[model samples]
Target chain A: MTSETPAALAKAAERPRPALSMSTGRAGDRIFAGLSRGSGLVILAIMAAIAVFLVWKAIPALQDDKANFLTSQEWNPDGAPAKFGIAQLVFGTLMTSVLALVMAVPVAVGIALFITYYAPRRLAGVMAYLVDLLAAVPSIVYGLWGLNFLVTKMTGVSGFLNSYFGWIPLFGGSETGGRTILTAAIVLAIMILPIISAITREVFVQVPHAHVEAALALGATRWEMIRMSVLPFGRSGMVSAAMLGLGRALGETIAVAMVLSTTAGIDWHILKDGGNTFAANIANTFAMSGPTGRSALIASGLVLFVITLLVNVGARAVVARRKEFS
Target chain B: MAKRIEVSGLHAYYGGTHAIEDISMTIEPRSVTAFIGPSGCGKSTFLRTLNRMHEVIPGARVEGKVMLDDEDLYDSSVDPVAVRRVVGMVFQRPNPFPTMSIYDNVAAGLKLNGVRGKRRLDEIVEESLRGANLWNEVKDRLGKPGAGLSGGQQQRLCIARAIAVQPQVLLMDEPCSALDPISTLAIEDLIGKLKSQYTIVIVTHNMQQAARVSDRTAFFNIAGTGKPGKLIEIDDTSKIFTNPEQKGTEDYITGRFG
Candidate 1:
């Protein structure tokens, strides 16, 4: 239609344009909706892309027969013919993660409870901040610190245990054995402690004041209120917090490798010698690997990916059940 | 049957802010007492003091004597938990431990006091729900979540949970404020029934509620900013509403000033 035609003129009226004076919803609201939809779509697309890429890269390793991607323990990517299995890597990974969680959960929950329930108000904020700072420290820094400082401390502790509980298979190793799975687990605990503790402290603080007051008014001691009101209210947070920390521990590489001094073998004694986690096995052996070795490493990585997926799924389930903090 | 709660020259503060000024009143056993005033007039604060709940807040402190049956509640040797076991509180909002079910909510108080035999717990839960007038509504659904109840029902559930231990006194802070008229009436009727067996203390912004439920009415008012609250007048509910001695109490009850 010609620019001056009635059809063109009506089309001009039909064109979308921003109205300055006439208003229904404020302009800010429309902009907010636009921003939210844009960001949401971007996150969705990114996550989908990552999942596709991970699955694509993982297929080759899974398909390899000698890789024993799911079952066997022999992870010799550098064997004469380059046949490898994930069995030992899986065992090592589970051992290290469970050990780390065993050490961290109680301490994390206790620290959180102490800060929220018992610490003097004037001091509690500063203590909470210090715990938060732990999470800010980089994973590499934790590795360095674990090697330089924590290893020696754990060595001393390992010595005492060797003397006392050495009869047990796990602790039978020489106390001087500095690099072992036990050491790696303790290092992992320190690394993830802040994550669990911070979430738990926040959860404890979010317990409704009225619930707390109701408990208190009923003649509950401070500890009783914590047991009755605070802990139960924060239970889901505590569980998810632990799962979040587990996610971190699952894929950690640099720190675990730095401290573990891992060897390629299947040994039930965690304190005897260093055993490699899947992430550490990949990081430690990737440079020296041939094609089969790399394939085997990729196979282990696939397993690590599955573990993290399961952990994150569990965390989401817990988060769904938890009440809002406010 | 005539237990007494005596508060004498009581003062309480949050940090440096005076929340409750010097106030004294005696509550009779099985009698309903209402603390009424404008918002921030220390009614809730004073109610908290009776149960030693004020101390639970960080920086909250109280001074002076709070005697129940002539025993000082704030005495250093007194156990706060023991004190709470005897006096229970219902909050402004219904909080039924969202994680727990209807059965568990009533049993919580008993469990806290170390009463754990299953038969005994079941008996107490049934009796408490009946006392709160909520047994019939939730009897079949004791396994359901307490949070899923209607507002009034949730509140009665909370009340049942509190009274499960058979406390000597009950403290309520605006127990009906969040409820509708029908729910409010139900709770009010429950309160009347409750006071015959347990001493009851309540705080409310609605003057008509104070008039309707309380056996004795206390009129409290703010004296000055940053100062403790003062008791303007306290007497029989009818006398306080119709023939108060203080002009401030009359002005307040008449809707001239709050």
Candidate 2:
């Protein structure tokens, strides 16, 4: 169209421009989307395959069982007709992990707060690095240290608790053996402290500066400011971090097996020896097990997996209900 | 209960860098005073020093005499937390406690100060919400999350939260800068009402806002980049707007310079 011709200009504007020849960007996007979908499907496939294999192997052993798998506090999977139950192991797993969480979470949160708010500026970085280093220490090393070193030191402490706090059923055992569920829980607590603390630190750090200022401006003490601003903002994140720590506590094998004096009976006494966990049982028994015993261990592993999954889902749901704040 | 502020030889620093230098002024009780300055001139920093909020930052500190009546706020035995309780502050952006209900957000300060009776908390929360002009909109939804409110409403909620503690002096650091014009007007009106009961100090980049809301105005200036900010002039808002005593104040008010 000529430059001065208004009608011709309008017509030209209405016409679509020619398309570019290259379509690589669109092709790249499609390929990337497909790759991500494929990866997700691969994870699903692996999980399903594991579930199916566990069920396939476990059914025959379960069918031959002479006792109730959910109630009987005995493990004789290699016995004639395979007589075993996960009741005791399940109790041990839950009790130890819950105790560990009860012990570690508060301390972890405190350490996180100290690092984020209370520590000298130069020291905070060094302290955070040390906690990270603690997390990276091998579980096997922890197992060795927990069994060799802590078990001995804990005897005196266990004796003290039994003397002063033994009125509670959990700590009401006559015996004061340090090789007990409490010891295992204590070790697990130390092992998981860094994981929970580090995540909580990040969450605390992410609390908006404005909210903290709001609390401080309203005459909040440092601890009170943390309570009003940092704690609420990081609650969901802390729950998720605790859940992750719980997952590790549940699935932990070498350290729990090494520290816990395994017993097949369900006992409420936390101070005395006698407890078993799904992962610890599997780890301790797998080496000497026959085919059916192996399948039984696999079944126990399946239950542990489901329990961890349920814990994660439950934590996620709790976090989701508080999503409005986020 | 309102209290007048008398600041003298105030110097604030962030690490080694001086932020606000040798600022001194008297803020009358039951009136609004506005501090107007360009970006990075530390008007906000000086405002924070009145209540000891500046030291919350790592390596940030203030050296000065901030006299609230006869009490020296920076005295060795004076707790910063108590100073803050007496001199409340509102921030540039609305920062309602995200996890709390509107009711809980308003009651947060009282709870911190050990007010536990449910009846007392309810009374103070209602009164403070009314004081911030937020009661009518949020009264029916007291259980709703404070963060669920609109930006303007959230800012008012923050104000309600501050006033719930019954501070004598209220500091607002560009409280309406993030709001739309209509919301800004609403807050300006609220400030005018609030001035009758509290000694109010506000920092604003908008010179017209200072003229519109403040009874007295202080102009802050920096010589160059990285230089500490200085208070150039303080006078009646009307006189400062029409005919300033200092050339820098006149230049800034006339938009010839910052």
Accuracy of chain B in candidate 2 (TM-score): 0.98
Q: Rate the local accuracy (lDDT) of all candidates.
A: 0.85, 0.92
TM-scores, all candidates, are 0.88, 0.93
Q: Which residue segments of model 1 deviate by more than 4 Å? A: A1-67, A78-80, A152-156, A159-163, A166-176, A323-326, B224-226
Residue A224 of model 1 has an lDDT of 80
For model 1, how big is the CA root-mean-square deviation?
Answer: 7.9
Per-residue lDDT over A1-326 for candidate 2, one digit per residue giving the tens place of the 0 to 100 score = 46679988889999987678856588889999999999999999999998899888888888888999889898999998689999998999999999999999999999999999999988999999999999999999999998999889888888998999999878787888878899999889988999999999999999999889989999999889989989988988899889989988988889999998897798898988769999999999999999889888888888888999999898788678767556
User: Which regions of candidate 2 deviate over 4 angstroms?
Assistant: A1-27
> Ten-residue segment with the worst summed lDDT in candidate 1 chain A?
A61-70
Model 1 lDDT vs. the true structure?
0.85
| Interface RMSD after interface superposition, model 2 | 0.6
